[model samples]
Target: MKFKSLLAKPFAAYIYSKIQKEMMHAVADQEAILQNQIKTGCKTVFGRGHRLDDVHTYEEYKQAVPLRDYEQLKPYIEKIKQGKHNILWKGQPLYFAKTSGTTSGIKYIPISKDSVNNHIDTARNALLCYMAETGKHDFADGKMIFLSGSPTLERIGGIPTGRLSGIVNHHVPRYLRTNQLPSIETNCIEDWETKLDQIVAETIGQNMTLISGIPPWVQMYFDRLQAKGGKKIRELFPDFSVLVHGGVNFEPYRPSLMDSIGGAVDTIETYPASEGFIAFQDSREHEGLLLNTNSGIFFEFVPAEEVFDENPTRLSLKEVKTGVNYALILSSNAGLWAYNIGDTVKFVSTEPYRLVVTGRVKHFISAFGEHVIAEEVEQSLMSVAGAEGLRVTEFTVAPRIQVAEGLPHHEWFVEFEEAPQDLSSFSLQVDRQLRKRNIYYDDLLRGNILAPLKLRVVRKNGFIDYMKSVGKLGGQNKVPRLSNDRLIAEELMRFLQ
Candidate 1:
């Protein structure tokens, strides 16, 4: 009865149509966005050194700015941390978005005012797209349970720092904040477990119309809710209509999450990162997420095969074709210039440039040159899990490289809600699926170069225990699904022992 969408719906439809039209000319938009960014930042040190002072066109900008990763930009980032002005972008960053880093430790990504505002606006557009697509407006009348990070922003090198979700929470629209769950006091609870406990206590009886979070944490909340009510979630909250999810691929978690819901609910996936808001679900029936082309981020792609080459071909939006796996690189208003986000994706469409996240640049197994990606492994496991009626709680895979006695094989540490009756068959099915999916894996198996995939059933909540032990309990932290070496495997197994 509280249909507020009479006006909002038309506006959403118009905005979505406008966005679609703009995206058709995505390459042109990307070009202009980058040019403007260069001009605005030309006086900055990064811009000056990268020859942005003279670069006028996309081609010229590309030629001048060599593709670089986080390490190469660290020195400049350090200068910024010391309160330097105009280091990467104009003015000091409003804050730094801290994420996991390799080599030198935590990565501090600069979040300028422009970048933050764009993130806020892009997020709003995502909702508008959803409203235009679904026409489910009743949810707006009730509460929304958003299972994101604690909102207790802390300082990192003089600038406010926090997880992406925490930063986003601070900007939740005034109208929506009225229905948002987890009181501000409860949100500030540092421990994830304690925060969830408090959140459950606060909203267990409320009319939850929407739920949003990463699958694992959201799954935890659902489990606790079901435990409290001893009833199906649908019965507990009949008004719940949508589940917004992202931060990891939803395929592996979809079946289990659907089972938990006990009824139908619309789902929308987003590809928001600490560095930028990239893409979101716009089409109700589409397979891949629609790219946020006109958002304050310029994107480039390098073919996966040529990712490590001395001089890889960097393709603009217009040059990218459907189905080719490419390493996604971003030049954003956040001061990330042609920076690799370590994600690989494949375009599923060209006109509006919709794409699916394929895998991570670093989180893949290839010790034997089988070169298996997270997507392949996940797809294979999900297939087997589906056929055998399995619900995976968590899993991680690693190459069991050269033990004193055993042959080289991939090891899986899996935790499931419903344990398979025959673990051996489950393991065999996973191996067969992998071979079927990846030609290189099939070839390796055929040649007997690699032994069969090994599956080890971890104790219930073993991954939770492990993540906690490693000080990575919550807030956008997920264990890498596939590791190239036995280092993680050994450490994780040792932790179990």
Candidate 2:
């Protein structure tokens, strides 16, 4: 083992033990966080406006502060942007994480001094937990590359602002700096294709051990490497052992990624957002991510079905039940209160609060009154593809409500790395699996209200081309799995094979 790996092993063990202890006392830690947030809120302008001073319990907090999305909270954020102090949190935010929004053009999410530590620490602990559990710390001996946005910042209201990943890039520890790949100048390139080429040139010959990024982008990198060197990634970088992925479901992309690597590696899934780092995969044996309850955030879950109601049922960590789908809501030290982050999740284990991200609240197909979520489609397609030993590059689903002669149906745009022998039969199996998982879809098909989903084969690099056209090619952007309308479907039709 390298000297760095030997030094990190004991530290990883200590951090893992601390994390295990925190998981054991998750409920108590959550309660303490909630109380602390409430106390801090009393001194903010938002708290005064919402009558937070009189709120003594969870029920009172709920009644005093209504759930708010980005649009609803924009007014207060605007004041903060104008250099107001104690508007949201105790003082001005340390940074604004700028992200593209669907309805709203651009969103500036605040990261306060108290909340930023959670983002950095949670990520470190996740890797440390893996090292402690598996005794595999040799990856630290070689280079580690996190494919992220540029570590560039501009001032907004005198506060540093940039992408969340970019902001975090500035805080990477001194020890890891020498081991990090793709020099700062290369990362600063705005265009993804240009940056991608630069990254390939810089790291292709290096001893890359750990690779991290969203799966699709990482897949793109792998393709570039293979094209350049004419060798599998495993052959090019024999020490490559761990892949850290987030932002989307990994199952659909796993077959293709594994094929490119030519072997197996430890993969870790993380639940991170501009608001906070919510969860991370803690064990290789576990099925779900271990919730970050001891962090500077308090979590709540509203039943998915009732999310649009005037007042939805909000359940705390102690009250959530396994297998029920719920929309994630959070109140954090960042001064976001009862904020709905638009993600739907299901608890797989309530004992230690392990949950799986189901889908986004707005990213679903309900055009035909049959609410089809991302989870159902991902599971159905992956199940069928895995059974057939086929490889899928990427895919998305959108409703097709108009037809010339027959009933309308869901249209699946699939890009295949290895096409199945019988495409029609594969589509049928996928539809069957989805029907079994979702009774509403089955009922719609039985009632003749909708036709079976049709698969449209897409040309290679179709999704990538579409994203590039829209100027959202990389850095935390992902193709939505499903949509209620045909906006994306119409645009995607141009790429059909």
- Top candidate by TM-score: 2
Residue-wise lDDT of candidate 2 within 206-230, one digit each (tens)? 9999999999999999999999989
lDDT of 1 by residue, 86-133 (tens): 999899898888788755588888899989977788767777888887
What candidate 2 gets wrong by more than 4 Å, as runs, is none
Model 2: per-residue Cα lDDT at residue 400: 92
Stretches of candidate 1 exceeding 4 Å from the true structure = 3-7, 494-497
Clashes of 1: 0
Poorest lDDT segment (10 consecutive residues) of candidate 1: 488-497
| Model 1 whole-model lDDT (C-alpha atoms) | 0.85
Clashing residue pairs in candidate 1 (N, C-alpha, C atoms within 3 angstroms): none
Query: Which residue pairs collide in model 2, if any?
Result: none
